[model samples]
Every structure is written in C-alpha cells, then in structure tokens.
Target: MTMKISIERLGPRRMATLAVATLALFNAGCMVGPDYHRPQVRVPATYSELPGWTQAEPNASAPKGNWWTAFNDPLIDELEPLVVVSNQTVRADYANYQEALAEVRAAHASLFPTIGATGSATRERAGSGSVSSAGTLVNSAAARVVNSGSLEGNVSWAPDLWGQVRRTVEENAATAQSSEATLANATLSEQVALATAIIELRTTDANIDLLEKTVDAYQHYLDVVTEQDRAGTIAPSDVITARSQLNTAKSDLIALGVARAQYAHAIAVLVGKNPEELEVAHSAAMPALPSVPVGVPSTLLERRPDIAAAERKMAAQNAAIGVAVSAYYPEISLSGAAGFTQSPLSGLLKIANYVWSLGGSASETLFDGGLRSADVDAAKAAYDATVANYRGTVLGAFQNVEDDLSGLRILAEQADVLDAAVRDADRGAEIAFNEYQAGTVDYTTVATAQATQLSTRQTALNVQESRLLHAASLFGDLGGGWSTDELHDPRHPAAPAAAAAGSVQGGATSAGSGEEKVQ
Candidate 1:
C-alpha cells in the first residue's frame, strides 16, 4: 500500500497535535539520559546471489511510483492503489499511528503550566431573634439575610527543571514515528499479498484452459477408438481407456473453478471488499515476470520500513532511560492565586475585598528503598532489549532480501529446463500420434506420449507461476520503493541545543510548563 494522501486523511486535531509535538521538541533543555545512535549490524557488502546483477538507472520519464506496473498487466495496475486506500488492515494501522501522534501532543503539554478559574456564591441567615419563648414571631422581625460571592484564578508550574518533560516528549515522538513506519510496513505487506493472490488466480485460469483443451482432445481420441473398436480394428479396452481419460480431464477442469473462486475472494478481501461484491475477470495470459533490482545489503537499513520502525523504537526506549534518570533530581513547583471575596455580595470587586496568595516548594526523594535505582535499571534493561530487537530486525531484513534473490535465480534455471522438456515432449507426442495413425505403433504408445506431453506442459506452467510469484515477493522485500527519508519527524531539521533552550520562555508563558512532580 502507498500513502500519497496520508496527511490529508488525518483530521485537524491530528494536525494540531503534531504541531504541539514539533514545538515542545524545540523547547526543552538538556535531557538527562544517553542520546540515541543506531546500533551497528554486520551487513554483507553485496547480495550473495546477485554477483552479476546490473544496477538499475532511474528514469525521470518513467513512473517509479508503481513498480508493479512492470508486469504490464492492466488488472494489477488497477488494484495496487486500493491497498493503501481501502484495505481494512492498512486503515487500522493508520488509526493506531494517529493515536500515537496524539499521545505525543499529550506528552508535549507536560512542558507547560496549568491554569484554572473558580467561582462560588453563598446565601444564609446571619442573625436570628433572641426570644426563645416567642421564637416564631420574634424571628420573623429580627432575622437577617446575607449573600456572599467569590471569584478566583490560579496558576501552577513545576517546570521541566530536569528535562523529564522533554524526555517524555522525545519518547512519544519516537513512538509516533515508529507507528508511522509500522503502518507503511503493513500496507506494503497487504499489497504484496493481493498481488500474489492475483498471480495464483491467473495461473488457475491458465490451468483450466489447459484442462479444457485436453478434455476436447481426449473426446476426439475416444470417438476414433470407438469407431475402430466397432470394426474390430482396435481393442474394446482402448475405447474404455480413452473415455476414462476424457472424463478425468473434465473433472480436473471443473475442480479449478473452486480454486479460482477462492483466489478471487481472497483478492477482494485484501482490497477491503466483500467477496460476493467483487467480480474477477478471466485473463488467460499471465503477467510477465518483472526484473527486480537487488541492491547491496547495507541499503536495507534505510530502505525497509520495519527496520526504520525498529530503530525508532530504540530511540523511544533510550529516552525512557532519561525519563527514569530525571527522577534523581529535585523538583520545584510554583503556584499563585488572585481573586476577590466580600460579604453580602457588595464591594466584591473593591481593593479591600481582594484576596491573593503566592507560594512555591521544592522536594526530592530523600529515601525510597532503592525504588528510583530500580526504575533506572529497568529503563536501561528495556533500552538494551530494544537495541537487540533493532539489530535482529536488520538481520531479518537481510535474510528476506537474500532469500528472494536466491529463489528467483534458482527458479529461473529450473523454468528453463522445464521449457526445454515441454518442447521435446510436444514433438514426441506428435511423432507417436503419426506413427499410430500409419499402423506403425500401438494406441498405447500414442497415449503414453500424450500423457508425458501433458505432464511436461503442466510442470512448465507451474514454474512460470512460481517465477511470477517470486517477482512480486522480490518487489516487497526490496521495500517497494520506500525510503527511511519518507518517515516524518515532529522535530525534523534538528534544532540546536541553544535554540531549543531559548524556546523555554515562550513555552512557559503560553503552554504552561510542568510534568508529574515526584512526591
């Protein structure tokens, strides 16, 4: 699947959240933990099976966006675009990515202060009649009513004093980027699956055509044998054999419809539609085998979406270590309230009735039974785990590329051998038929030759189908023209540390700077 319209589909809230993340990314001071760097993986300089492979030159005039068009099949071209747009799995991954971006914004908000307003009103009887003896009558004359009201505004901030908020924002931004890469990986996988199903369906169509022609040929053979049997020129068993072969061919032809229908249904669901709603047309011609370029192994690091996602996860986990380390530092909080209060709701806005308070405090974990130390150790362990996972992903990507290349090469050679065998088998069957017609050979020789021809032809067709499937798989393993450069960073262009620090004043005043304070 391709995401040409990804940004447009995300609503305004998503866009706004991303903007907040961008800002906070540029507003933080020095983060507490280790900065992120990609872990080293030992990659072979070249693909093992692509020793003589020629590098493809980019053509500005040709379309690189849809590489599957190399197959030159109009049907495939029509369906490939739908994988990113309508595929249910792709859409779900996209939603998950959007949610991750929103989380980044939530994390970004922690860098600012919190402001709130409150208002209240009260009504009561302040005085009552002194007479207990004549309570009811005296209270009516002596009772007094009072009304009071107050309005207040308050602001509180703990500051990102030790970069905890910044590190958290960093972690979430990395996570969001990871989610974006995951979406890309899923879309590509679904697109490849759809292409493969179509290839199988096309192969089924070819198989059915082959069987139909075979059935017709057997029918003709049966008619000739029946005529000869009636005249006592051929054995009655030959007639029975011919009829049985025709019936078997017909049965095989009928069975292919089930597989064809299943493949069509799978393709429909892959593009996000009900099976019954889709109508697949039969095309006897298979898509041509495409030439897939196998680049050097090191390029997979920047070319594969899964590798990018794994790398970003490492970054997120590394930032988590910073978030943990930030715990060791002291936290400072400042709060202020300003308001007016008065009796009887009179002069409530006057200077004497005004009330105000300003306060601040600082706290540090004096002792926690090694809890903070445990947290730091856990975060480091998690980071180490992600590093291993990232390297493992890179290794897996290398394996995918190598496997596709080797399979395609070996399959090509096998396909050549089968094609040659098919040609010889066709000639052999023709010769046997001619000899039998001239009474130089028995009918059994003709039957044997025809069966061999059919077997060889079927095997060749299978190899052709396998080659097409491998071609499609090759495109997917090669990242389907994706690049790590396509991944968006909320803090792209990497702002200088001084510039990031300078933005603190604005972030404090406008967005309010604060994170969860350690108690």
Candidate 2:
C-alpha cells in the first residue's frame, strides 16, 4: 500500500510517532531461515597411521618458537618468516580479504535508514509569444523573468520488515570470515613451500659434499694403482681402470652442481627474491628431521584454515536461503520529505512556502511465474553444494595427514636399514682395496666394492631428503598451527599481535632419522 499524507491532516508529532512504530514493528520481525549448525562428520578416534609412529618429545614448556626451528637450521628460520610478508600469492589473498570486509560493511548499511538532501535553483524567462502567468492572451507580452528555489531533506528506509537485510548482512559477514581464513591458509601454504625448498636445497649441498669426498678417495686409489703398475705388481690395464674410475667420479661430482644450483634458485624465489638476488650458503649438514605429533582426527576440523574457510562458506550460503525466502513477503518502506519552495525569491523559508510529504508503501509481487520459489530452490541447492564441499575438504585434510604419517614412518625404518648398509659398504670397500694391495684380490673386486659403497651412500641421502620433505608436508596438513578461532571478524579485526604464538603447534607422528646430520 502506498499513501500520501498532507501536513494539514497528520501533524508533525503524529508522523514522528508513526515512523517510530514502523521501526519497532520491523525490529520485531522473525528471522526466517534455518539457524546454522555444524554438520556431523565422521572423525576417526586416532589417525590410521599413528600406530608405531615415533612421537617427538618437543619440550612443551619451552618458549613458543617457529616450526622450522625444530630443524635447528638458522637459514630456514630466517627465510621461512619472510614468506608471509613478501609472497605475492599471500598478498593477493589479503587484498581479497580487504574487499570482503568492504562488502560486509555495505550489507550492514542496509539495516538502517538512508538520509539525503537535495537543493536546486533555477531561473526562467518568458518573452513575446509566451503565455502570460495569468493565462491571459495579451497582444504584446511584456518580457518577464521569475526565479524559483527549493531545498529538501528526505529519509527513506525499508526496515527489514521480514529480516531480509539482516540475513544479507549475516551472509556477507560469513563471507568475509571465509576470506580471512583463506588468507591464513594461503600464508601457511606458502610458508611450507619455502621450508620445503630450503630443506631440499640443503640436501643437495650434502649430496655435493658426499660426491666431493668420493672423488677425492677415487683420486687416491688411482695414485696407489699407478705406483703398483710402476712396481710391476698391477697390470697396465688395472692402472687404466683406476684412472677411468677417478674420471667417472669427477664427472658425477660435477653433475651434482647443476642440481645444487637449481635448488638454490628455487629457495631464493620461495623467499620472494630473484634467483640471482639471493644465495643460500652451502651447509655442511642437512637439517634434522623433526618428529611430528599426530593429533586425533577431530582436531583437524578446527585446526585447518582451509576447513574453516569451507565451513564458513556453508554458513554464508545458508544465509542466502533466508534472503531468498524473504522475497515472498511484501517490501514495506517509509519515506518522509520536508522542504520549502518559493517563486518570489524572497523569504523562501517562510511557513507559507513550506511543503512536506509523509508516506509509506507496501509492494507485493503477486505474480512472477514462480520466480521467488525458483530463487529459494536455487539458494537451497547452492547451500547443499557447500555442505558437500566442506565435507570433502575435511576428508582431504585427513588423507594428507595420514599420507604424511605413513611416509615418515615407513621412511624412518628404511633410513635405519640404509644407515647400516652404508656402514657395511664402507667396511667392504676398505677391505677390498687392502686385499688388492696385498695381492689377495683383483683390481676389479676393489672397483665393485667401491661402487656398491657409493650407491648405498647416495641412496641413504635420498631417503633422508624424503623424510624431511614428508615432515614439512605433515606440518602443513595439520594447519601449521592455525585455528578457526583466530579467524578475524570483519566487524572487529584483530591486530598482528593477537595472532597465534610462534610454534609448530600440532600433533604429528614420527619420521625419525638416525642420529646423523646431512653429512
């Protein structure tokens, strides 16, 4: 219903009372939608791969510190912190969060009245042939000019009579929360990437060091064989074989440089620098493999930022259903305008020149070929999709954590076996060389033993790298110590200091390595 009221009939006090009553009625309108409840999800009592997993004894009483710090590598500690500040991907997501906050604020604005003012001044002129103001037909119309001015202030509000605006604000607020969680997830992911790159780079350095020492040993063997040939003990063919082995080792050592340089370049980029702009110094040892504490499955729901983001989206979508349902009700609005208009250009603000309007409107779309119903259906469908997405995300998170746990557990056992193999191979190579010198074995036997030693040593290095990489993977899958509770509200953003304490705070199982550094 639309109405027009004259000031002469409805007095100013009555109009004010009407507006107040309208506000009260709308404020009491029932919110029409399903309230959000976290959907039930199947969570395991314990991680599937937790059995026989080596849980780390991280000092709980120790001051909170970075997850990478568990590796005890200064380089990793320094570079890992930079990923959040300078990573372009994280920065882009943060910009997206800023936009989401603006959207929330915009939606919130709809819950209140909109006040505006308008002012206009116009000059009009009439000459011959123009009708006179008195509607008289004069033979010669005299030149006349009139000036008019008007100033008006108006207020209009829809009042959320069926809670449509409130529901919309709820939806946008949830969306902003999801955006914030997404930002945290991105930051965590990039930081893990940086840590992984640094770990691999250090592993490469260790490999290069191993090859260098092997090359040196081959050179020494060649020298001893050359002397034996001069003494007429070893044949010339054996001398030639020794030289070939030395040259092969030298080539293998050189090949490792290519990989080392590439890993370094990758590390530099991960730290937000051009490959050439930054260089990681070669460390003599690889980082220590950290033991991850494997927490129960249910903790993942709150721990993973991606999970939090997905859950928040479900809420936002659910609110959309309320917004759609609200369309079934009539839109009730109240508007009032007060102003003065005068043509004499003198005392335009006088009571005689005052003009005012007080009105209300109720518009119901009685026929739309089921548009509102279709919209409601579409909203419900979208909401269902989000629920599925949220569950899938949770399942994926569990899969990641389990995969990391299994890899670390299986690899740690292999590391132990390889460590023993390396020790045995070292002894065999020593014995074979001594037997050749003592005229008890052939030079070919020495070469075979030495080859076995090098192969086993290289295999051990590979396994060690695998373990470290898996540890980092587990750290990330566990949400990198983030919690949904930390997700900032759009209406009340928190400061940086309010964020999580520095720590790799999560439960993970063991991928423990032997008591050996990268060497």
Candidate 3:
C-alpha cells in the first residue's frame, strides 16, 4: 500500500498563516541603536551689551505682518514684498527647501512595505526530436508552438530591526527643517540688502543735492571774484581759487550719480527686474530711521534663522550617528510573491495554476577591515563638528544683536553732536566768506571754511545712513519674522496651513512656545 499526500491535505492554509505570523514577529522586533536626543547648549541669561536699552515686553516688539511696514516707508513696503517672491537668490533657496522636503517624504516612504505587480506572455516552440542515453535518436518530428502567460504580485518589507530607516527619516526631517530656515535666512538677507541699498541711494541723493547747492554758491562766488579781479578789487589768484572750488563741488556732485545708479540697479535685480527697466527717482528727502525693538539675548536662538539652521543641522548630524551605529546590526527583509501561470493564456487565472512563495532574508557585514567602526567614528566626528558650529552660530547671533544695538546707540549720540557741528561749520563758512569780501581774511581762509562745512554735512548724512543700515541689519538678525512654528513636515502638506492659522495675530513673539527650544 502506498500513501499519497496533497498540498490541501498538508494544510496550505496553515502554512500561509504561519508565514503571516513570522512576518508579524519580525515587525514586532525592537529596533536597534540609540534613540535620538537633542544636544545641550549653554545660553546666556542676558545680553552683555544691552546697557541703557529697554527689553521689549513679550510680544511687544514682535514684528507684525510685513516687518518693513513698521518703518512706515511706502517704498520699502512695496519692494520688500517682491523679495519674497521675485528675488533670484531667495527663489533658489525656496527651491532647495522644496527639494529637501521631497527628500523627507522619500525617507518616510521607507518605513512601509512596498507592493508590486508583474505580468508577462511568451510564445515558445519545442523540438519533437528525442535521443537515448547512448545518443541514438528515438524519434524526430516537427516542432509545435505554444503560448504561456503569468501574472504575479509581490510584497517586500525591510523591517527597521536596527532603526536605520527611522534614523534616516529623522535625519531627513531635520535636514528639511534646516533648509526651511535657510530659505528664511536668504529671504531676510535679500530684503535687508534691498533696504540698505535704498537707504544708501537716498543718502547719495541727499549728498548730490547738497553738493549741487554748494556748486551753485561756489559759482556765484566765482562770478564775484572774477568781477572784483577785473575791477582790480581782488587778486587774480582769488578768482582762480573760486573757480577751483566751484569745479570741485561740481565734480563731487557728478560722482554721486554712480553710486545712485548702482543702487538703483541692485534694487531692480532684487525686485526681479532688468537693471535698465527699473528706475528710482532722485529724492533729497531721507526717510526717518524707525526704532527697532531688541528682544532678550536668550530669544536670539529662536529669532535668528541662521541660528535655527545651525541647530537643525546639529540635530540632523545627531541622527546620522544613529544611522552609522545601526550598521553594526543585521538588515532583515521579508519578501513574498503570489502568482498564476499556465501554458495557455486562458488558464492563467485558474486556481490549479496558482503559485506562491514566502521568504525572509538577513544580511550583515561580518568584517570590513574596521570600515564600519571607522564610519561610526567619522559620523561621531561630523556630529561633533555640527555641535560646535551650532554653538558658534548662537554666539554669533548674540554678537550680531549686541553689535547692532551698540551701533544704533552710538550713532544716535554721534548724530546729535554732528548736527551741532554742521550748523557751526556752516556759520563759520558764512563768516569766512563775509570777512574775505570785507578784505579782513584771505580767499584761502574762505575756501577752508566752506570745505569744512561740506565735510561736516557729508559726515552727518553718512551717520544717518549708517543708522538706517544698522536698523535693517537688526531686523534681519532678529529672524525677519520667521518662527520655528512655521516649519512644516513635508510628509504632511496640511501641517503648515494649520500651524499658520493657529499662529498669533502678529509674527513670532516669545520663544518659549512652538518647536523644541534649543536652550
């Protein structure tokens, strides 16, 4: 007697169940490697250089929508918006941020199983000739053609047994965050540049106005000296001196046009226009410098985009350490395929022609001449570098705030003193010219006093320009109204919308809320 066994009799259903159980067991395994923790950084309690400065109350100094509007300059308000959308450098940074978001999504995709399907058809011909073991032909006939087809579905999953995929996802997430911060930094930088350029342009305009007026006055003096020399009331050398002063003033007036044109061209590029297409009309009126609110130094970490970027980079590098450490363990993958096949196309889907397979694989590097160890060490070194960079960025951010603060404060005082000096110099120039006309002083003394007046006036204008530039720098150093809460995970497209809707009415305020505080 003989016994016959069938797949059904051996319980194929039970085998399928066991395969699923095995897959579940592998999925349930704990991931290897250390969990990520943000690196600690020391922060100062208060700014050292904030003497005589009042700290803004919570949310008091926060920039409202469109920080440039705070300056009350209509031109800046108009140009600042263009930078967010049209500036080439800002646009490039935005694109880079989008790419980083895509990378984050790609990394997230690895956490789940992948399913695929395949189908194929083939026509084959089989020879009818047969041969014996001795190589003697038993039969010979014409070949016959046949058609075959198959359809298959496969599933593959590499379980995160060593947390490699998870760590990769974390790394990419941090990188995307870093990219977002970079985008904000780029935008802020361009906006500040545009504002600074505009301020300088206006200063040039004011300088040109002053020089032109001086040129007109010098021309009148030249006429007076020429008439007096011809009448034998003044020496011919006085006429020559007067002509030289008029020409010098005219030259100074002409030189200002170059800076004005260059600034206008820069503004045009920043607003995404051709240099020749955009023109800013000359205006002698300078916009009054707006008061900027400086928050506490501890908030600098949250307020500065560059600081945020550096911190995110540190987090990313920290996750990379886990990725490198995970290599010490094995990579386990589960794969299975279910299919239908038959010699004829009509029978491809029949239950009797069905086929399936289930399998699991694990691979690990046994030895690679200490390459894995070296990789881990390298990752550690890289992580250490980022930590140092992050700390350095924080220090730099504080320094920026301090430098701007001290600059504004000192410039304010200097402006006051220079204002009085300019008035005194102008009065002295008037006195010297009158004394020369009365034959009490030489024409050379008159020229010296006028030159002193021009120098003092130009100095005052430059001081005012410096104050405006410093204010713009302070705004940028304060993060240009960006906050960590605005950062969105690309994996969730709606996350940013919800966050924006939930954000405070104004821009970023206190640093205690939102994403994890570095301090």
Candidate 4:
C-alpha cells in the first residue's frame, strides 16, 4: 500500500517554515558599506561685522517659525503662501521629490518575491492507430477528444547579498531629500523676491509722485519767468533756463514709470498670471525696515535648505559608491513555480497531477576587461567631487549672509545723510523762489535751486528703497529659519537634516548642535 500527500496538507506548514527561513536569512545579511559621515570645515568664532548692532540678552529666545511676520507688512505676509502653490520652479522640485520617493519604494520592493497567478484551458484530438490481438492480425482504429485546464503560479525574489538593493534604496532616498529641500529653498526665494518687488514698486510710485509735484512747481516758476520776459523785466536767457529746468523735471518723472511697470510685471509672474492679467493698486507704501535676528553662523546649516540639500547630495553620491562596489560581487536570485493540471476540467483540482519547481541562480563578472574597476573608480571620484561642492556651498552661504548684513548697515547710514541733504535742498529752493517772486533774485537762481531739490529728493527715495531691498536679502540669506524637521521624518524621504549623521565631524560639538535650528 502506498500513501499519498496532498499540497493542501503541507502548503501552510511549508509556507510558514519558508517565511521564518527567509526572515532569518535577511536578518543575517550584512550591510557591506561604510556608513556616511558628514565632513566638517572650520567655522569662525564670531562674525566680524556684528560689533555695532545691539546684541540681544544672553540666552534670549527669538520666536520660532514665521519670522517674516516680524516686519508687520500684511501684504508680504499674505504673499508668502502663494509661493508654494504658484512658483513653477518650486512645483517642479516637489514633483522630483515625489518621483524619488517612488524610486525608493521600487527599490525596497525588490526584497520581496513577485508572485503571479495564471489559468488556461485547451482542447485536443488524438488520431486512431492499428493494433494486433490474439493469434489473428486485427486493425483497431479509434478517435478520442480531450480537454485540459490548469491553475498555476510563479514567484521570484532576489536576495540582497552585497547590500546592492539597500544601497540603491539609500541613494534614492537621499536624492528625494535633496529635492525636497530644493523645493523649500525655491519657495523661500520666491517669497523674498515677491516681497522685494512689491516694496520696490511702492517706492517707485512714491518717487513718481514726488517728481510730478516737482514738475508742477517748476511749471509755476516757468510761468512767472515768462510773464516777466513779456513785461520786459527778465532777459530771454532766464526764460530759456526756466523752460530747460521744467523739461528736466518732466523727464525724470516719466522715467520712473518704467521701473514701476517692470515691478508690476514681476508681481504678475509670482502669482502665476500673465503680466496683463494682474494689476496692483500701488496704495501700500513701504513700511519701516524689518529687523532680522541674525542667528549664529553654525545655525545657518540648520536653516538653509540649499546647504541641507548639498549635504544630502553628498550622501546620495556616497551611496552610489556602494552600489558600484556591489557590482564586483555575485548576484543571487530565487524562483519557484507551482500548478495543477488534468486532461479534464473535473480533475484539474486533484493532487495526482500536481506540479511544482524551485530554483536559484547566480551571476558574476569573471572578466570585463577593466570595466567594473572603472565603474568603482568613477563612483569614488563622483563622491569626491560632491564633497568639494558641499564645502563650496557652505562657504557661499556664509558669504551671502555677511554681504547682506553689511549692505543693510551701510545703506541705513547713507539713507540718514541723504534725508538731511534733501531737507537742505528743499529749504534752499524755497528761499530762491521767494527771492525770485520779490524781484530780488534772477530766474536762473530759482531754476538751479529747483533742480537741486528734485535731484536730492530722488536720491533719498532711491536710498530708502535700497535699504528695504537689502533687508529682504538678509532675511533670505538666513533662510528665515524655515523648518525642515518634517522632511527628516523616516516616513518622509525629504527630512532636511537626514544627512547630518547626528553630529559634525571629529565629534566636535557646537553651540546649537542639538537644537532644532534651520537657516
């Protein structure tokens, strides 16, 4: 007597055993690559330019998140949100981050077996044949119809022996993080640009208004000089000078409209509209310059998205080295198939005709004429290049902050002097006009005074506008302390400081190393 075993009796037990075995195998798998470590450069002990500014009380905390609101500009606050939704470059970076996340999932998926199920039915006919029976020769001919069906499945998986799959996943994850930071940087820049442009537009409108009033005043003076010339009280040269002065004032007023138009066009682009579609009323003038909390220099790395992105890029490149090194090792994969078949549909589920197969395969590059070696070398060189770029990015970030701070300081001082100059010129012009009206001064003196006043007022306006622009630059350089903590979420591939490795190189500690600070 023979005993039979059915798949139904053994399948569950075998599956559980295989699952445990697979888990054990993977748990035993060693990740074969050097973990990433961020390189450190020398940071200055203190900023050389912060001497004159009033320092905040020691250990005093500035408000976190939404630092731009400190300016108290309602329009600027309102426009910041539009950058994330409407800026084209930022949208593109967000899409790239999504794609990178999908790639990571795709890589992680390789650790599991791909199972596919299939079914089919078929019909066939068999021809008859001759046969001999007993002592006499006999011919037997018959025809039979047959039907067959099968339910089947196949599975395949690749074991990560040299950490190739893990490294690939790591690379994609880091790239995704970089892309995420890039999006944040783009959004921050757009917000800054839009605010700066609006401030500039308002300033231009103010200047235009000033010039228009100055033109009107000069026209009044021209009329007076014309009347005097008609009455034979003034020379033709005085009339000529008065007309020239009036024309110059009119020209300056006309020139200001050009800048106003350009700024309006920029505003339209920021809101994702055509230049002709959007129009600002230009009612809001520039407010007082915003005060920025210039945090410590080391805090910049935490705040600045670009610096974080550059650092992540280095991590991605480092992972690439692992992927390339993995090429030198053999690739191993496991595959399996199981099915049941029968000549008739009624018997298709029976165990007697069951079929199954299990297999594994390996491949290695025995000789490639130096191709694999070149690939590894190329990966290492790429990593080296990224390290250099990361260093450059840090330096550039510091330089930008310093430059903007210096500009704000210098421009503020210049604005004070220009304001005084405008006041002096205004007084001089009033005196000259009064003397001209009283017939004690020539029309030429009045013309010179009017021109001087217009020039000085315009300079003051330009200087005021420059101060605002420089302030915006300073805030942008500081990353306005944007939060990238969300990106570092393991669920989120774009964690901002995911590449930080928890500390700086050589284990040297800094002031705010443990704090959640972003540039």
Per-model CA lDDT versus the true structure: 0.79, 0.81, 0.79, 0.75
lDDT of 1 by residue, 315-404 (tens): 999999999999999988867787999887988888898787767698998999999999999999999999999999888888887887
TM-score of 1: 0.86
Winner by TM-score: 3
- Lowest lDDT 10-residue stretch of candidate 3: 510-519
Per-residue lDDT for 26-55 in model 4, tens only? 635866666799989766655567875444
Indicate whether candidate 1 or candidate 4 has the larger lDDT: 1
Q: How close is candidate 3 to the true structure, as a TM-score?
A: 0.87
Expressed as tens digits, the lDDT of each residue in 130-237 for candidate 2 is: 557999766655777888899899999888877898888889889988988898888888888878888887877888888899889998999999998989987899
Name the Cα RMSD for model 1. Answer: 12.9
- TM-score of every candidate relative to the true structure: 0.86, 0.86, 0.87, 0.87
| Candidate closer to the true structure by TM-score (higher is better), 2 or 4 | 4
Clashing pairs in 4: 302-518, 302-519, 303-518, 303-519, 304-519, 479-519, 487-494, 487-495, 488-495
- Indicate the TM-score of model 2: 0.86
